[model samples]
Target: MSRIPQLVIANGTVVNSFGRRHAHIVVVDGKISQLVDATEPVPDAERTIDATGQLVIPGGVDGHCHVAQVTGRFRTLDDYRTTSTAALWGGTTTIIDFGIPRDARETPLEAVLSKKALAQESRCDVALHGSVVRWDETVPWQLEQLAAEGVRSVKMYTTNRGTTMADGDTILKVMREMVRLDGLTYIHAEHDPIIADCTAQHADDGRIGIEHLHRTRPELAEETSVKETLAMAQYTKAPVYFVHQSTPGAVDLVTEARARGQEAYSETCPHYLTLDDTVYGSAFPEWYACCPPMRSPETVAALKQRLAGGAIHTVASDHSCYDLTQKRERTDDVRAMPHGLPGVETRMPVTFTAMAEAGSSVEDFVEVFAAGPARINALPGKGSVAEGFDADLVLFDPSVQRTVDGGALHMGTDFSPFDGRTLAGWPAVVVSAGRVVLDREGFHDPGAVGRFVSRNGFREHLAATADLSAATL
Candidate 1:
């Protein structure tokens, strides 16, 4: 490893969500010390990287990554080391994971604390979101503990009953508490009744296979739940963020709420913007199995349109590390299969490709890929290439293209949903916290250098990043 106390990235275009400029970034002690003009004399440093002709953007902030996550009878294969290693490979220097309780017996406080302990194995920085499966007398105290631990957000689901769902009463109660705590509420919105009825019909008709996954979870179910959740957020006046929204209508609901001065945000995954329901008819439908499953091609197009128009706040991987064996275990029944895709390693190229296809600019992509997620999640030190920020930066070449091969990825998965797809904008060099991690030669093992980062309260965080929202909007 080429270790240096002071590193200079010279002669590159600094692309931030706010704007772009040609500058030489100086890194010292894991933070960006300065941004010198390209026209000025290059500052002397212990080592220098010639980033000439490269696009220097802030390292990506993947707000929805599941590392070694346990859900029901299944758990993802990758740990923090594997997941964060993959993140650095893909130019994501920071990742926020959910501390969802493993079961009803496991308290949310224990779940979050356990994840924090495990995060010491990460190769990159990490943050967490607390979760609640039900509203109990002790839940509010648990949430207060999470807030004190710097985990300012909590995630709840409107579906996945008996396993991870929270009733409407619980949801409303959590939102009200989040408001009181000055934190954000993270929700997985999907109308369980709509899904259960449709799925039951499908099962009775012998159509509950992987191929029928998308059909069972109708887009209207997602829309209905988004609206319902928005009502609760509005009543509680809590800043809310919806994860993995697959339909344009759901995104539009959040947009409308935001217009009404409600602090609402919609986050869509890369698979939702790229893959469609047609994959269900493919030879390997199990590869596409996920919650709030991929929508029709028309829906995918509309979601991309929503993204291009700035209605979406973040683009997350929703990365689950199940291999082909686990995926094949329940090929005949989507209900038993572990859902989610191995995507943290490919988020950069896939999102860059999708954004280009949406006719959006590079700066716009940075907003969703890095800035928006960091700000909304309260990780202010991440998602930008500027003075005094963490020296987490990536040098990318948008002109460079590669074909994705699932087996070649580093997310501890054996297949990729986007395998064989030619994508552009791969990262050439990655620096995390002033350390040279990935470059032309290869990855430098950083060990468990990633510590748990604390986040600010949502009210203060949003206020600080308002300029970012205004700039992108």
Candidate 2:
């Protein structure tokens, strides 16, 4: 026990999802040692930092990030190294990415394996969610292998039709398999028929451009799809998670299901929480061309209200990095454009601002920013600041602010969705795996590669250990 205290962070307010405490944090071998009371003697350590006025919080966990991800004709520009580094800068030490099959011929297991190999280049820890576009006799075996790989969640689309969508039969069969494996099922919920019909009508009227995106994908489609997916989840008793939920009605459906003893979760992105459909009318409409595009101002406000009410489980960046040129290339046709926004570096500030505007507390922000994602995703060592947890933590001023400049950021993109807006909650110092990765001086990469974290199964681990609702949100 000679190295019992290798590092010490003194005099900071340690914040948790449920509470906060003024304590000194001690670290040993990359895991938290303990939180020594201020009245107690400071534990001897090899290094110590005086964080007099900063808030020491668990490093952020971004559950929806796209790195070097391919979509249609274009691919996101950033790789594991770039995105993870940017995540550290933003106080997010752990990021969960999707292993979606590039084509129908590529097996789900193959996609997950490829992502794991690429994730080795990350400077921060990484986890993956596997995806399936179809169900064959071999899919059950592929899922078993995915669980063995620690990628426990599987994603499917209900709206992409021939390209990425899995029909109702495939979806139900996959949910049953996920339940058998004690894993979670993730759905991109948007009614396929509604979206297809709306897009066709827009095309007929010559209004299928990015500027008409919000109208093309209406909120009713999302609410309807959510209800359908929840029904399936309830029928199969499978734990289901809806990603990038953009409407309050959709979140309410999940909330009501949870009340009925169903395992359901709703995750909304920073874009849906802060930005509105007005971006479609702006000159740079292509910048907001993601599927299930930004909703109206009324919808945005209502979604924020849901988050404040604790109906939303997690707030993710949904970070997709495409340069301005790729976005410009397909501005004329929304269907052909690359979808997603560059916001990994801005998730902390943006979410903080949104919740603050909603009159929520820091404890609530802590819930969505770090704890909720870790708990729902079965990441045991990544979320809390308590003893034996990972020493991935950030020190920051809660009231400090900075205006965003997309070019000045590090996601390897040329623009930001929240450009020109001032935001708070920027990180001052970031520690990951017991190393001071970012501080006032600069970032210290030093050839550190992030580990691929294996997640725990729901029934095998979570149901036996914690409350489902508390663990999820």
Candidate 3:
């Protein structure tokens, strides 16, 4: 019998959501076989990495991102190859992107299969949250099948109108069905009426500037939708996660619901936590245009405080990369401009630098960015440094500092939202499944060995408290 291949990462401060200690991680067949003390002499088979003064933590799990997604007329700039490479360079070993149907004619299963085909060349692990575009009697069965196939979550929109938004009753029905199927719901919560009314007023007044984009979709719009969805989630007994929460009020709602022992978790992105609406007044405001626009600085500050206090559960990138040419063409009308920013490469460093400056520790970083997201997304073998977990790790050097430059990044976009910002704590080495994908020289594409993770399903803690009586009437 051939001996199992082994690799050891030695002399690093292994950190997790709970704590950190000096340990040597042993990897056998791409799985963590042991976490021994650094002082102990271990038998190493293949290779060893010297992580003398670095912090070793679980690789990032970006639970919300858009790569190769087709939106209206234009497709996203980054596909699996570029997006996954950027993810690895940024210490993200796993990403959960949306699998959206191209049109009404396509079934959810077909959408998922197409997305998986696109992800076949990914340089890092990729999973998908199937989008439910066509809701009918057959929808529940499809959702259950998708869940069983490792797509444990589905995304629903409430503001895109004829494109992807589902009505209130439709959402409620879907939530109820999700409850029965053991599938989780990820919602882009924004009241369509509010946004539409505001947009109509702006158009009537000929105020279609980027500033109007912020005015049309104010914090109240998000708050109203968030509160309403929480109620539906509470009544339907389904676990709902709000994505890209930008307002303090919405975060408060999630916190309050959890206080009531409800099943809810709020996810905020790096852009929302750090950037303010002030960017709308910049020379090129179209570049910063995204749905649920950045909130007031005061709200941003409050969100940071809440994040530190554990009110905010997870921080994701929501990375939707669009080229500068795409954004520039619609500069005359903000509504026509593509929404999103290239963030997969900058997500971890930017957020890490901000929270670290706010006095957050390494453990807090792991909890929110890695472990918490992994747990929420149902990736059992991710987000921790321990035996029996995947050897997906990052060796971070906190002393190194670098300024952000979009042109220098590996992302497909030409500009960075974080340009000129200096950040520390960059991952000097990113190891995915025991293979080194990023090192001192640069990123290396280790072929397409990334696997689709079949998630273990929702956290039973919330399911145990679900109100089954709230099922569809």
Cand. 1 TM to true fold: 0.97
TM-score: model 3 vs. ground truth: 0.95
Worst 10 residues of 3 by lDDT: 464-473
Full-model lDDT, candidate 3: 0.85
Tell me the TM-score of each prediction against the true structure. Answer: 0.97, 0.97, 0.95
> Which prediction has more favorable lDDT, 2 or 3?
2
| Model 2 regions more than 4 Å off | 464-473
lDDT of candidate model 2 versus the reference:
0.90
Candidate 3: segments with Cα more than 4 A from true spot: 1-5, 460-473
Ranking by TM-score: 1, 2, 3
Candidate lDDT values, in order:
0.92, 0.90, 0.85
Of the pair 1 and 3, which is ahead by lDDT? 1
**Cα error, candidate 1, residue 218 (Å):** 0.3
Per-residue accuracy of model 2 over 1-473 as CA lDDT, tens digit each: 35557789998988888788888999988899789986677788888987878999999999999889987778899999999999998999999999999887789999989989998899999999999999899999999999998989999999987778999998999999999998999999999999999999999999988899999999999999999999999999999999999999999999999999999999999999988999999989987888789998999999999999999999999899998999999788888888889889899999999999999998899989998899889897877888878999999998899999888999999999999999989999999999998888988883546989999997666653365336534
Runs of candidate 1 exceeding 4 Å displacement: 1-5, 467-473
